[model samples]
Target chain A: MTQGMSLIVKTITRLVTSFITLFGIYIVLYGHVSPGGGFAGGVILSAGMILLLLAFGREQTMKIISHSALVIWDSAGALAFLTVAVVGYLAGDFFINFLSTGEPYRLASAGTIPLSNMAIGAKVGAGLFGVFLALAIFRPGRHQEEE
Target chain B: MDPFMLLLLALLAFMIIGSLIAAETEDLLSSVVCVGAIGAGLAIIDLFLGAPDLAITQVVVEILCVAILIRVVLNRKDETHRTHKDTFAVGSVLLFLGVLLVLGGWAMTTLHPFGEPLLAGDQPGVAQQYLTNGLQDTGAANYVMAVLLDYRAYDTLGEATVIFVSIIGAYVILRQRGKLRHDTGNESDS
Candidate 1:
């Protein structure tokens, strides 16, 4: 029931996939200096993955990232984000930026925020991809009926 | 009316037409496309309102949504049954719309003026503090990001947790098995 898209779409997707992924990474990394942040960038990242999933089909996409790995990545991203927050407790605050903040507007600035953003980006990207996979595939009922 | 207001009105009319098309169309594909059009229109409106972040998010989210919805209808015939118009249902809907319109008009009249700050209520100093001292405090060039990731971090944590929880919920609901075949019951996951 599931298959890759048309040739035109596949060709275009091949050209556009890397750009989307890079743009998403840029958004997440430069969040403190730009209009986007963790959530927005993460959503964009997932959008890219979803694009590949749609164009290449579930079997091929699964080859890139298996179902269980996605689950672990999703949970791990969330855990890393939470760890960032928890780490601040050593400095006597719930979410303190304990790390030394670099010069403003610099790529490596914003204390602990950049790490948090990357963590969130990973969590959101993986979580949404997993959700899409669950919805688009793994149809037990349909498989049984086909049998 | 000012050019901004006029342009906004035009976009609003476009969005309304798109919505109507989506609602009235029998072809589910066209209906989904109309919804995408509406989303694109709304993103343009967001740009007019001076929120590029929101506009960007809206555009990408709309792309994702349109793709998913198109996949749902692709390669599938429209087997949905059509129901004839029911006067009673139509009347009830119209009555509800009337009530909603009246309430919306009242709320608009009482709401903040156009181009004015919507959330600068009694505690206007909060946003002012963020705009002024956000850089020194958080070293973030973007005041919005500073507020979100530094000043209001607990809220961000809550949001991330909520996303995780919801994703877990979806995973649980979409699980195809109460227990996997050829697997012992000893494997446990929460």
Candidate 2:
């Protein structure tokens, strides 16, 4: 199978991946004040990773981010989000805002929203990457002939 | 009509044409590209309708969908020509389209005018209330975020759970397939 694209594609991928990832992080962090949120940002981040996989080949990308590690990250993100919501129950309601609201439009404002967005961003990013990885790695007929 | 309305109408027309081309195209790659074009058109329409958040989400989702679809198509063989054709298929499709057009026309007639708030009286509606109070109550400048993560947090949690469950479901199904493959490989080796 063809490993990946040409050298030019790989170089472009290397140059753009970091910028894409940084933009995704910015979207997630400033979701409360921006047009994007966890879902969009997460997809963008995974798109960056997918671009890297396409340009660098699955083997090299896996060396950077193993499948098992992605699974753990995905699970941890979901659990963290759940924990944040469950903790809100302590404030007299399920999924309530418990923390004090600071100045509006500030990063520190919005209480637990930013944290939730981060958790969701991580979960979505890792989950999407995992799906792509699984689909790419699964070779249905590769073992059939040998078997 | 005004320039904005004219532009929006053009976009809608383009979207309709794009969808038609995507459906009619025999080449899978061209179909995928047409679908991406339609999605981008829809996003632009959403932006014109003053929903920047929706536009952003739509564009990103479109990119992901196109990528995954291209990957799937790349591995699969091109569709073969059909030797047998059913006479009733085209008739049924046209009938369905006619019914959809009728229903859509009726729905459009029943809807409130575009850009008009639904609230009738001087008292503010729920959406207006949210916009006014979102910043003070949730400390979020974006009213959409305030509503999603604060006012309607329970619903947001449900959405999160749904995503998590879906991921787990995909993982389990794939892992099972992997295990079956492994078992068969081992047996063949033995």
Candidate 3:
């Protein structure tokens, strides 16, 4: 009975975590038309990562997610955003809408805004995950020291 | 139900969840995380209400604050060591605060009067025009960027100066002035 209860709890947690993660991605992609944006979406995504860390051991999680990779990705994402903004300035004026604006309220529309949002999403998501990993590293469990 | 009603429901739900988490968590760090989560939710709600400026600022500031807290908590020696008395005291305090909050919120709901659409206009107010026309005039799509760069360029300059000043202050406090002094055997004998 105890084992069954534990299994149920684990399944529920997985469901919740997956839902939040997918929801976060939806928010990041549809931010311009909806309430969620880069920051909120990024944090929610990180919450999923945190859940993974809790369910899977820290070592297993770290095997998949490296701090250095996250840092590099975050920096690159930020640089991409800055590059686009700079490109706008070099082309004509600062922050010019470089992409062709499609039909109003279309997914393809928003003219570089969506791209910028994606860049921000990447940066924020990686940055936050980095923060959590750093925290875990600094506070390893007692069993870790013994090993 | 109206979209506004839905938003209000979400906000209220968040408030309740935050209160419950804050109340139930015996660990200070977990309570702080709950508070941070609540703050992030509030910021999202603000964005939905068409206040991106406030939302961005809140999100960034809160993340930095949480990062600092995480750093501190990780470095601390004690993770969990709470007596029954401490738990009781914390729980009682949380309950009292929650009740007081509920009363205040109820009063606010009753006393508050809805206002007209302050932003209803064709030409758009100074703020709106700045958001719309700033891109055309100064060529920036990010509404915040347009506002900060063209309409409020002076303010941006001031903020940049402040950032520079803070950086210098930090360097002054943290930078090493001299090279490390090594003690060789001869030097120690001398």
Task: Please write out the lDDT profile of model 2 over residues A1-147, one tens digit for every residue.
Answer: 368999899889889999999999999999998888888899899999999998988888888898889889898988888888889987677878888878888888988888888988999999988888876775555542211
Q: Using TM-score as the measure, which candidate wins?
A: 2
Docking class of 1: medium
Interface RMSD of each: 1.8, 2.0, 7.6
Worst 10 residues of 3 chain A by lDDT: A138-147
**lDDT string, candidate 1, A59-134, tens digits:** 8888788778889989999999889889998787989999887899998998999999899989988888788887
Off-target runs (Cα >4 Å) in candidate 3 are A1-9, A140-147, B1-124, B130-190
Candidate 3 local lDDT, B1-190, one digit each (tens)? 7888687678969967996997688776787698788878878887777787568657755765576576456545545665567888889999999999999998977653543344534546776666556544533345554354334534533443453345345334333333233544343211
Weakest 10 consecutive residues of candidate 3 chain B by summed lDDT: B171-180
Cα RMSD for candidates in order: 4.5, 3.3, 10.2
- Residue range with the least summed lDDT across 10 consecutive positions in model 1 chain B: B181-190
On residues B28-60, what C-alpha lDDT tens digit does candidate 1 reach at each position?
999999999999999999988988878887897
- Ranked by TM-score, the better of candidates 1 and 2 is 2
Clashes of 2: 0
Candidates 2 and 3, the one with greater lDDT: 2
lDDT by residue (A1-147, candidate 3, tens digit) is: 232225565677667978978987876676555445555676667767766665664675677777667677666666666666677678776666666655544456556556665666677677666666665654422222311
Error of 2 at B40 (Å): 0.7
